[model samples]
Target: MKSLIENPKDVKELRENGILFSRLGSDEEVVELFKEIDTYGLGSRYVFPDVKMRIEEHCNSKAKTWMAELIHTYFRSPWTAVALFAATFLLCLTFLQTFYTIRPAN
Candidate 1:
């Protein structure tokens, strides 16, 4: 499919092709559409589409598992992932120490 950004003037055509504005639309056009809507004096607002935000939101909303979502959030920052691994290792080490101790017996 052609990119909506590549066809800013063909907003209606995109809609006809089953591309909703929510799924695809130019930011400037969206702003203009909101302006037009405001010109009609309707109490509404429009949020410009952001590709990165849309991707993250989709991942968060459609994730089948909480772990998947958590991993996605953690990996968004490299430091968070590193910290997660370190904390997990520390916790496991503590558990191992408590459970598997070498005892000196008579």
Candidate 2:
């Protein structure tokens, strides 16, 4: 956690997300606290090994990563999302019209 917080903005984001709470003074104080804390003697002990392993597995999955990238790229804005929906609808309508035109009617 200390390594992750490099500046006051990082501290502010963590505090906004309820991940960090400090009554010392401000976000800068929280950053300073993390900086001053000594983590050299912390013994190696698994607090939640299973949860960590599950998170690692999820991160390693290619399908999940691809899906996340797809969403982030195409659905980041409302206009892009609407454009994708309209394109898909048009393609489906084109396919149906082609099928009806090629079919023999009684």
Each prediction's whole-model lDDT (CA): 0.54, 0.78
Q: In model 2, how large is the Cα lDDT of residue 36?
A: 86
Candidate 1 Cα misplacement greater than 4 A, ranges: 3-61, 64-74, 102-106
- The positional error of residue 33 in candidate 2, measured at the CA in angstroms, is 6.3
- Provide TM-scores for the models: 0.35, 0.54
Give lDDT tens digits, candidate 2, residues 1-106.
7665768986876687577888888888888887787768654344456765675688689999899899988789899989989999999999999998999577
**Model 2 / residue 91 / CA error / Å:** 1.1
How does candidate 1 score on lDDT?
0.54
Looking at model 2, residue 12 earns an lDDT score of: 79
Judged by whole-model lDDT over C-alpha atoms, candidate 2 comes out at 0.78
Best by lDDT: 2
Cα RMSD for predicted model 1 = 12.0
Q: Which candidate leads in TM-score? A: 2
